[model samples]
Target: MKHGLLWIARALGLFALCSWLTRRELRILCYHGIWDGPGHYGNYLFMSPGKFRSRLAFLQDWGARVLPLPVALERLAQGRLPARAVVITIDDGWASTVAHMVPALEQAGFPATLYVTSYYAHNQRPVLNVALAYALSRWAAGERDSTLLPLPGLGQLNCPAGDAIALHRATDQVIEHASTLADDDARQAFLCSVISATGLAQDPVWGGPAFRLASRDQLREASAKGIDLQLHTHRHRTTCNGTSCLAQELADNRSWLTGVGEGPFEHFCYPSGQYQASDWEVLRRQGIESATTTEIGLCRRGENPYALPRILDGESLSELELEAELSGFLTMLRRISRR
Candidate 1:
């Protein structure tokens, strides 16, 4: 019902008018990995390649000007942004990014910034937490055995089969233990045992690129192909653990990115759109030029650089809904509702 009203608004050319009014506001688009494999693995985190291509098509059809992130921010601050200026940013450097997203961007002749978290990149392993969660989520509710599975070196798990919360708790327990493993090999072995216990060892997602981060070689190749590589932190975390921990994250992030031969590495995206008030000073201390959040809005001059907003494009968004975002219709509605 609400979608019908949105379509009506678009047909009435209200989106066009709103877009014109917000022309000076910078529109930042945030994306994650592209997933083309089987089953529903959540839309926002890993969008389908076809949907992403269609989104790029929509941007072209809307006559939006795509700009590099750093250049767009510079122009925005100087009050020199073009009409419908948009910046594309991909977070986490998923392995699928190099395989799927980069080619699409290349074909479109659009430049994008990839904010990579180096932990997985350096380790060259499927992230333990994500892998376990996905494995748990894919198990049929009915097939979940209520019996506790015993794991050596980590004690027994009494995960209630069909309960999402219980599965999540079990995943956390495994993750906590896996984190203590001495190396990726040990961790991989541990993961295999858990998957075997869950009776999902044959699931194709494990063998596929679904849970992997881009390899170091692929990252270098991506940068060489005109993808601007940037920082998303070393460990993909934001902490209340103090400025020093945060600073080390950036240092480690930059340390890995240096191998990519791209730099100044000043721009950052908060992991999972998470940040705090005190983070501003932490970012400032690190010489971060601009930082983007998952907040949905258009960027304007004089807003906090550390908390700049972005529209998160996902698989579930219809073409019309995306048009509303790119055309600034949604932003206008949000403002009006706040009044």
Candidate 2:
């Protein structure tokens, strides 16, 4: 109750301040996945669709002028924006995003920029980590015998063969290696074999569209519905490979986008929000107009286009929390209180 009251007070204070002079900073909101139900199976990267809808409604009801990201950036570049300007961006391609978010967005009449990981969209396979997560969820670590695989730093990691502590460590160890596989096919095959050999029942949802990437049909439909498809690179990691690899990854992402008849990609988002300062040059060279990072702050003019920041909202955030979030008052109080 104290926290709730504090947030409400913060909201009131900001509204009073804004009555005299409005804050013109443009806010970029980032979301990842949207699911109708709770986040499950180590999949906490989702926001409840109902909450997402409510947040949009609140923004619209409060009269925030939501804009497409590219348009918002263009307007901001020109030295102005609508009052309380905001751009909605969802990162990484998830089928639930198309399934649940599209309807919510249409209801709110808001436009969003979706940064899709091209490799997943092109392959239509469950993300290797997500698959690993699902498998790990139901694992009875002592249930079965599978030949142990060499796990790099860990040596001979076993599945359905370790204790509770061992299984936890093994999950991390496996995902790390999966992320390094050269090709998606090899990674998928490796995961499939591991899951099967471990006697783990692959969740039914995994094979269904729920855990897979959005289909080409879905991407085209989202485009028709006013979503901007942007670059998130082919493998979702850029700097891990060299600078040239970064360019090639983006090239692959665009090629996939073009093949689906869905885009003229202009914007980018760093995968896992990981990037180095030097990466800005590579992105600019690729003709990306702007790139957003996981950094948190309102964007302003003269800010580096290649290193823009965003406001993150998720299933756990409530309307009141967002009220305090957008106001900037809550953060201020927290910083002061901390000091």
Candidate 3:
């Protein structure tokens, strides 16, 4: 019944959009990882390549003009966007993006911008949360038995292999709460406490392999392919307690991007779609011309370029849903202007 209501809402949304979008506006579609099969860590975070391609085709069929990021930004500034203008942006320099999504974009003659996390470009492994998720899922399916691992402060722990789903949920909650910590020390303290309290060291699911990050070579190869590399923060840090910490985060990111020769980077993506007013000020001072947020709206001429909005594209959106997203800008404009 819930699914049925969603379908109904989608249909109604598309109808409203069609009536609203009669002119051209700039629509930016944002994506993260594109995988053939969903990641074991968290399926909701990634979209299948087939769905992504179909979304591209839908935009083309609907008379939307796909432009490069710089071009899109320029037109948006001047309020001279053509009818049905759209820009595609993918976040995270996921390997699947180069292997799967890039080819599709190239074939479609669509230009896109990819935001890369500097830490990942250095080949750092993904956080323990993703590893925990994969391990939990495998354990739940009875695919594995005992696994070994070290928990910070707790030394080593063996995760058991049963009741995988429940274990995964508990681990997820722990990780999510840990993420709210303001700094590395706080995060580490929280994780250590969780590990000590849960006694997960004896569990098989906690001993799985760590997830790998994108390598520098992969990023260079992607750049060679005309994929624009932009900023996504170092360590993917979303928040800091004070201005000094925030400045350090930005500085560290800029330093990494420059050190690796992956920059002249002007665009920034808020980590986890998280940002504060201080974050925006730091971005501006650091020479970032435009920054994207997880906010849901279309880019308009008069909108602040620095706090630009992007639409999240994922498996949940069908072709019709994509249409609604594209046309959503018009609806937003009308609503805002009281037209």
Candidate 4:
């Protein structure tokens, strides 16, 4: 039904009309990693390099004026935004992104901001949460044995191999426990245990460097190559934990990021799109010029700078869906439905 509607909207020129109407609004595109793993694994967190290249082609063909994030935000405030202005943002600073996405962006001569969550980057490890999710999803059907993987304090991770909710609960428990481990080495050992238990230590997503964050040197190289490195918090968390947690995350994130590049590192993206009313003053006090969320829609003047929206361009989104989104037809439909 939705696909049919989109086709009809295109046929009726609604896409064109919506694009023209929202041409002045700022469209921030959010992306994550580029998947270089063997075979096709459909994950929202990663996409193939070819897909990313095609996305850049789409932006160019659609006549989008890609601007540096900071410049775009400044222009947005001054109402000097060009028609179909777009800001391309990448989250997490994945190794694949630096190896694949950054090169693609540079080849296209487009400016992009990378929101780097410092912990994994500095620690040089696969993100624990992601590793757990992958491990749980791939644990064999009959291998529901809790004793397969054991942690010192977190006991057994007994979970239904097929029940997603149960698996999520188990993952969370282990994650919380992993956080309490002594050090990065301990955490790495824990992850190794998980990989071994799932018998997936040989998988590229688990064993290879693909799932890791870009190292400090690689990030520096990307920065040198013109990718704007920005803050995404030290641990990929937000103010929901409290004002102090948010403050520490920012400070640590800033400390690591500043060591990588030059000055003016001010933009932020909420870790996991979590934010609240009380967050505005905290962010303002911390020198944050703008903060983006995972919220969907075009950003316009007068909207809160601390909670700007973005279009999450990911593996699941098709080209037609991307067109509908960029043209503002999807945003219009969303707004009408909300009313």
Top-lDDT candidate index: 1
lDDT of 4 at 89: 95
lDDT of 3 by residue, 236-284 (tens): 7766553345556667777776644356888888878877776677777
Model 2 per-residue lDDT tens digits across residues 166-246:
667778877877877888787887788667644554446545665577988888788888788888998888865344478
> Candidate 3: which stretches are off by over 4 Å?
1-24, 37-44, 137-169, 172-210, 241-244, 259-263, 329-339
Candidate number of the best TM-score: 4
Candidate 1 lDDT tens digits, 1-339: 878989999899999899899999999999999886786676888898888898888888878799999999999999999999999999999999999999999999999999999999888888888887776566534364454767767677776766677777877887889878998798889888878877887777878878889989999999999999999999998764444477888988998899794788999999899898888898999999999999999988887999999998888988888888888999999999999
C-alpha RMSD values across all candidates: 2.5, 4.3, 6.2, 2.4
User: How much is the lDDT of residue 280 in candidate 1?
Assistant: 86
What's the lDDT for residue 327 in model 4? 92
Residue 86 of model 4, lDDT score:
95
What is the lDDT of every predicted structure here? 0.87, 0.75, 0.66, 0.85
TM per candidate comes to 0.91, 0.82, 0.74, 0.92
Q: Is candidate 1 or candidate 3 better by lDDT?
A: 1
Off by over 4 Å in 4: 40-42, 140-162, 239-243
Off by over 4 Å in 1: 140-186, 240-244
Candidates in descending TM-score order: 4, 1, 2, 3
lDDT per residue (tens digit) for residues 50-137 in model 4: 9999999999999999999989988898988999999999999999999999899999999999999999999887888787666666
